[model samples]
Structures are given as structure tokens and as C-alpha cells.
Target: MLTAPIERMLFGLSDDHVIVEPHSGQLMHPEALVAFQRLSADARDAGFDPQVVSGFRNFDRQRTIWNRKARGERPLLDSSGEPLDTGALSDREIVYAILRWSALPGGSRHHWGTDFDVVDRAAMSDNYQPQLTPQEVCDEGIFGPFHCWLDKRIAAGESYGLFRPYAEDRGGIAPERWHLSYAPAARELQDFLTAARLRDLVHKSDLALGETVCEDMDAIFERFVRVPERCYPQENT
Candidate 1:
């Protein structure tokens, strides 16, 4: 297994790399939080409003989401957003189904506090439901303008060092248009994490799907955690 200190930071179990900056509903990384503030301010000036919906989730929180989906408490979906019948699946199949939309507990970037989900405040009411579907980020959806503005910022080098990790369907996970990652820190963490370390850590855990995750560590690391280095911003590349 990897060293404890490194593992702690990687899994977001320690606060060594982050500060408790209030954002959305939880604390966030100081650096990422500053960047997000600037970006949000810019967006507001342009007649758009972006609000964080999630940030800095810990291991237990991730486990709850994972366990719920694995046990069919939450709806699992295919790449096309069709409901999956978890009752018909083996434990292994259920693990994969959950991974299609959720990350293994320790492997989620939310642990690092440098990643978060956002919504356009202009498009939502007090009763607005959060489906977080890709269709909702399309040109016709309420958040369409927000994402379009983000794209233009990325293309013009105006984004405050944020980018999408799952910008497309990569076969291992679904496309989550709402998720934004701080490139500088996220890239460093992503590069340092290895399949061996991730597998070893997860295999040693008591999670219900631990064995299933370790069963194909290579593919999971490749598809879920490690994107092509080139896909990241210049610093990561």
C-alpha cells in the first residue's frame, strides 16, 4: 500500500491540502475556492449565475452514495440514462453499474475538495429538481447558457483554472456536465495516483464492493480515474 500521509491526501481523508472555505453546502479547497469565486463573479457580470451544488465530500459520504446505489436505493443508469435493474444483477454487475455514474469511495475527486458540481441559478426555482443529466446541459436546457459560457472561457483561456474531468462518455463513467475540477491541483493528484495504490487501498477496505473493484483495478483506473494525460490542461499534459 502507499504511505499513509500520501493516501490521506489522495482520499481526501485529511485537510492537509485544503482549507475549510465555505462553498455550496460544505467546505472547499482554498485555492480552488478562490478561483471559483473569481469565475462566478465573472459569470455574474456577463448575466449568468453559477452556483455550486456539491463540494468536498468525505469517504463516509461517498460510501453512502455508493452503498445506496449498489443496494438499489438510488437509480443506476446506463450511458443513455436508462434505468438499470440492480435486482437482476450480481454483486459484481451492481458494482460496475454504480461505477458508471458514481466513483469508488476512495477514488472520487470530491475527496480532494478541488472538484464540484454546479448549476445555473438563473434556471432554477426553489422547487427545481436536480437530475444532473447531460440533456440538461445541452443547448436547449436551462443550464445551456452557463455551460456554453464556460466552453467559451476555456477556449479563450478565461476560465479560472477549472475544467471538466468527465467531459465525455469514456466507457467507464457517464458524462457529467455539471462537474468542474480545478486543473492545477487535480492534475497533480491525478498524476500521482496509480492503479497499484488505488487497488491496494480499495482491496483492503471493508466496502461491500471492494473485491469487485479490485477484481479489475487496471480497467477501473484507466477508465474512471486516469484520463488521457493529454486531455487535461497544459500543466497536466
Candidate 2:
């Protein structure tokens, strides 16, 4: 039941498809907000305050992050979440490096309003800034116990409809334990989104490495954009 209007929201190009969630002032698909509230309530009962790090991001915001990273204005991290020197890297290599942690504009799931990066506010110091890296979720990391709690929730079928798209690294996008995609809506978008459509969108945008991204659109879609069918809530249930 994807409408022409709804499809517009899939590529981070439209603002009409989402509304502001009052509690967090985060823009999201209405259905996702409801489900997220349920998940948050449950997590709070367990002493975890589910704070959203990123919600719905538009193409412009994504592009700024990409272009900045490409110009060395922002830090680019490797697969291990360590900083890499990109001064001598080619534009194509820089594009791939950025994709390891950031999604290309119009290809990102954050555009869909059904996915977001989150952290447990209960574990953060007053001034703590979440890096959303694997190191932060390691056994000894500050957010380790929070992610462990999330693991248990997802495993016990208690995380509402939330699931990790990059739960396991399959050599595509690096694993992100902090990113949660709402299965009901996100699954539909994932299925309906075609590489051809994405190519058209990327070609229209002003990306940092526009030429390189256009040439490698299919590979990007298959590796960075497409998550396996195994990453759904039922698997957890």
C-alpha cells in the first residue's frame, strides 16, 4: 500500500511524511512513534532511558555530514571504529570510508522515519556524548550494559517492533548495535526500495563524491543499503 506521497519520504527528500514526537521533539512516522513509546516504557521499567541520537534526517543534513567527512572537516572511522587518515585517499576510497559509518544521502534509512540511532540516557554522564561505535558497546564500554540489556530485550521478544538492520556484519555496512529499525514500516520500505529508484535519486542529489557514488550505486545498494531478510523482529520473537 505504498502511495506516491509515502514513496517520496523513502529517499530523505520530503518533509510531509513525518510528524514531531512530542516527548523527544523528534520527527518520525506516526506508527513508529507509538511503537517506540512502548519500547521506551518497557526499557524504562528496566532503568534504561531510551534517548534518540538521530531520528529523521533529510537529504541536506546527510549530505553535509558526507561532504564534511570527505573534506576532512569531520573524522572518518574505519570498520573497527578507529579514525583513519583520509588525506591521501582518492574520492572513491573516501566515499567507501564514509559509507562504513554514514549512509549516502537519499539511500539512508534515517530518511524513512522508521529507523533511528539510540542510547540509554540512564548510563550517560551529564555531559556524555554517544559516539555510537562498537567500542562503546563492548563489554567494558560505558554503554555495554545498556546494549546487553537491549540484546536481552530483543532476544526475549520485548523490544516492541524494533530490530537492528546491521545486527551482524556481512561485509557490507559495519555492524551498528545502536541503530534500531521499526520492522513493520522499515521492512516495507526496504522491500519496495529498488536500486534503480535509488540511482535516480542519488544522481539528482549534490553528494560529496557525486560521480563516484553514481558509478557505484548498485554496489552501494547491495552492500550498504540492503540488509538481509534475517534482520526482522520475528527472528527475535
Candidate 3:
């Protein structure tokens, strides 16, 4: 996706990726931002204050997350949301554990500026930080009812072109109900990011467990990176 040696607009590498929006001052595709604004407005009208906690993340940022978890600087959580003992695990094992929660640097859908990790403003106290766990987004969790509301909105096709790509757990990443994607803009980027292209980028990166990751590149792309085709209705049209 990098168009030039010095050019870094794609994947939040350059400053151009970040534009100021009234609610979220993060990086975003123009169309995605528009849809998000509408989505937020609609949520507000429905008595919820939806806020975007995370938006477009750059390659270096994603790499830092991967490397830190790999080197034991950060905690690697399992499918059940418990921390793993990275000290005793193989590099390959650590890689998989990290991929369970996070994406590879170049393989993240957030690179397209069309995805968001959102939470309900009314659901949290001033000091509460969203853990983004399944527990937090389940029926009894803080954002659970909010997401259930979203589920209905998306089902009814009133989500302002947004949908939850990670709403289903398919043995790769866990279900992330808080993750919202602007399908139209995201769909184009998703098609542009092929396993071969991502493998090439990962190989050239300074990511931790580089070789171990490349070994299962195809499966990684299919499992951790690519979401269900149903999320992209534009693809069928």
C-alpha cells in the first residue's frame, strides 16, 4: 500500500493520515469518517454516547505492540483473556498468542483508516479504561447492551455503512463486538491487501518473530487478518 519510498500516507505512516474530526481527532478515511459521524449521531439519538477509542493505527505503532508482547515487555492474553507466560513459550507460540488479540503490523485492518474500536461514553467512569474483552462486550458487560443495539442497527441496514467484522469468533481472533468497520471504504482496502503482499511486507519489517510468522503466513492472513466476506456487501454488488 506504500506508494513511494518517502510517501507514507497509506497505513497512517504520514501526518496526512490524521485529520481533525469534531468528535475524533484520529486518522480516518474521509468516507469512513462521514459514516462514523452518522453512526455516532444515530447512537446519540438512541440514548447512547458512542465514542471511538481507537482509529487508524500506523505500522510502527502496530510493530511496537507485536514486539513488546513478543519480548515479554507486554502481556500476551489468551482466548479466555488471561495473560500468557511468554517466557516459557516458543517464538512461534508467542506469535500466535499475540495474534489472538492483536494483528501483525502490516496485516491490521486499522491500517486502512476504516475501522474503529468504540465504547459507550455513558458506560464508563472517568478513570475506566476499556479492556476490549469479550466480558466487557457481552450481554452483561459495560458495552454489551450498546453492541446489541448496534447488532440490530446493522441487521436493519441502518448502521451508516458500518458493521462489526469481528462480531463472530471463527477460531482465529476472538469476537470483538466493539470493533466497527466502515464497509464500503474498508472493502476496497481489504481486497488490496492480499496474503502474498502482506507476507512480503512482514518479511521486510523488523517485527518480532519475523521468520516464525512467515512460516504460517497464509493461515495468519486467513484467520487473523481477513474477516468474513459477508461484512462486505459491496463485494457482491
lDDT of 2 at 181: 87
> Per-residue lDDT for 52 in model 2?
79
> Candidate 1: where is the Cα deviation over 4 Å?
1-3, 20-23, 235-237
Q: List, residue by residue over 1-237, the lDDT tens digit for candidate 3.
A: 446532354344554655555675667767778888888888888888988888888889999988998888989888888878777898878888998898888878787778888899888999999887788888899998888898888887888888888877788887888888888877766766777877877788898889989889999889898877865544311
Superposition error at 196 for model 1 (Å): 1.3
Q: How many residue-pair clashes does candidate 1 contain? A: 0
lDDT of 1 by residue, 1-237 (tens): 567776787886776766664545556777788888899999999988788888888877888898788767889887677998877888877888888888888889988888888889878888998778788898789899899999888767678788888887778788888998889888877877888988877777667778888888888888887867666766421
Instruction: Name the best candidate (by lDDT).
Output: 2
Clashes of each: 0, 0, 0
Error of 2 at 117 (Å): 1.3
- In model 1, the clashing pairs are none
Where is model 3 poorest over a 10-residue stretch in terms of lDDT? 5-14
lDDT of 2: 0.83
Local lDDT at 16 for model 1 = 74
Computed on alpha carbons, the lDDT of every model, listed in order, comes to: 0.81, 0.83, 0.80
